[model samples]
Target: MSFQDWEITFEERTEELVEDYGDSWRLKFDDNIEPDNPAQDWFQYIRGAFARFQCSKCKKTWPSRRVLVVFHFRLDGRKRKGTVEARRFRQECRRCQEAKMEEPQFDSDNIEVLLEKLVERIRMRCYRETLDGIQRDFRPVGRSEGPHESSHCEACLKGVCRKAE
Candidate 1:
């Protein structure tokens, strides 16, 4: 998938989450997920999706299906309120001699797919739904060549992203 406006995708996914989970859950995108939340049932989920990125200086474009995304959420059953925070990993242009870590650009389809899995995870974790019969397909729209470079990935640098076991 090519680049699309992340803000719009986030808003759309949030609306879907609200529609499915009702008004009790509040989802937000943050720079980082705070670890000091007082919620006892706080949980975390990590997902990967294919995204396109371009070097700001060199204009070099590349595709990566290893772009990692992290979600932290908690459901306060007593108050019937839930909170979720998300953060997406970034990558630097490998071709550039000196490049900044660029934000991943996700197309509408990829974003939808990613958020769909997120909703499923929420149902399994917060809603206590079993994952036995859930569909686990999270394959991206296109294939990315070469192996993922942890050296250029922001999440990898911070030890937030991990290889699939």
Candidate 2:
């Protein structure tokens, strides 16, 4: 028969073999096996997989039991000052006492890297928005004399102050 016909026959035979063997024989199925109901979308699967956890203290529901860990890194070239710290906190429910513990799988280094990546993404977006706003408001006014310089904007300054408090 044709290649397509042979392939279909082989698939049917494999299913039959699996059924005949039952639990006694362990067959390693190929990863490419299609789901029975292929019409199910990814969103439906994700929604089903994502279980909600209720906080015992406040009775508030969370998407999952995982807690968010925030890492702060500061560097001041002029003063030669640099520091890195990690803080773990859970989104508080109606009542504040119940806090979910973060997954133990994430090590300090992993958390730090995640924070670094997040900061990079935020910085990129902030710079893009600032450039757009500047282009809209003021003319080039001729390029500056030295290398490019950057300073903490008001939002970043406020965030730093809040964290310190």
Candidate 3:
């Protein structure tokens, strides 16, 4: 179905999600389904989810009502401060999915590509959150010149400075 067609159904699902998650607003899909293009399906599911309301972050009506999809990964090795890592999928417009379906078969290679995309998405989201937190904490300090003007670490100071500059 076209995204426009899917939008109608997606709206209905979003209401259910609001009732279910309330403030948290997280939706986890079962991985067993094995969609033709799991990444596309993942995007479609999230787009459907956000169709219900305005996004808290962007404040813009969710474009195509899409939600960023991230895949969480953890290594089996030694102690790490943060055990989980994530990556996000590229925004898959519904048109892409429809077009992709015309191909003969969606195989493991496709899924692997999707997995990588999801991982990237997660990493970007995590980085964004970290930056946002740093900004929130340091906002009161006001903009400053020179390295030592801000109390934040050099990395953070550099980032903020770059953003300002």
TM-score against truth, every candidate: 0.75, 0.23, 0.20
Q: How accurate is candidate 3 locally (lDDT)?
A: 0.26
Off by more than 4 A, model 2: 1-66, 90-104, 107-113, 118-165
Once fitted onto the true fold, the runs of candidate 1 whose alpha carbons sit more than 4 angstroms away are 1-22, 34-40, 131-143
RMSD of each: 3.9, 25.0, 20.8
Better of 1 and 2 by TM-score: 1
Best-matching candidate per TM-score: 1
Question: How close to the true structure is residue 43 of candidate 2, measured as C-alpha lDDT?
Answer: 9
Which residue pairs clash in candidate 2?
Answer: none
Q: For model 1, how does the per-residue alpha-carbon lDDT over 1-165 read when each residue is reduced to its tens digit?
A: 332354455456557546766646655667666333423557877777778888999998888877887778777777767677777788999888879999888767777777767766777887777766445455464667688788888877887666563
Q: Put the candidates in TM-score order, highest first.
A: 1, 2, 3
lDDT of 1: 0.71
Predicted candidate 2 versus true structure: per-residue lDDT over 29-108, tens digit per residue: 12222222222221000000111334556565444222233333333334533232333332323345535432222323
Q: Kindly indicate the candidate among 1 and 3 with the higher lDDT.
A: 1
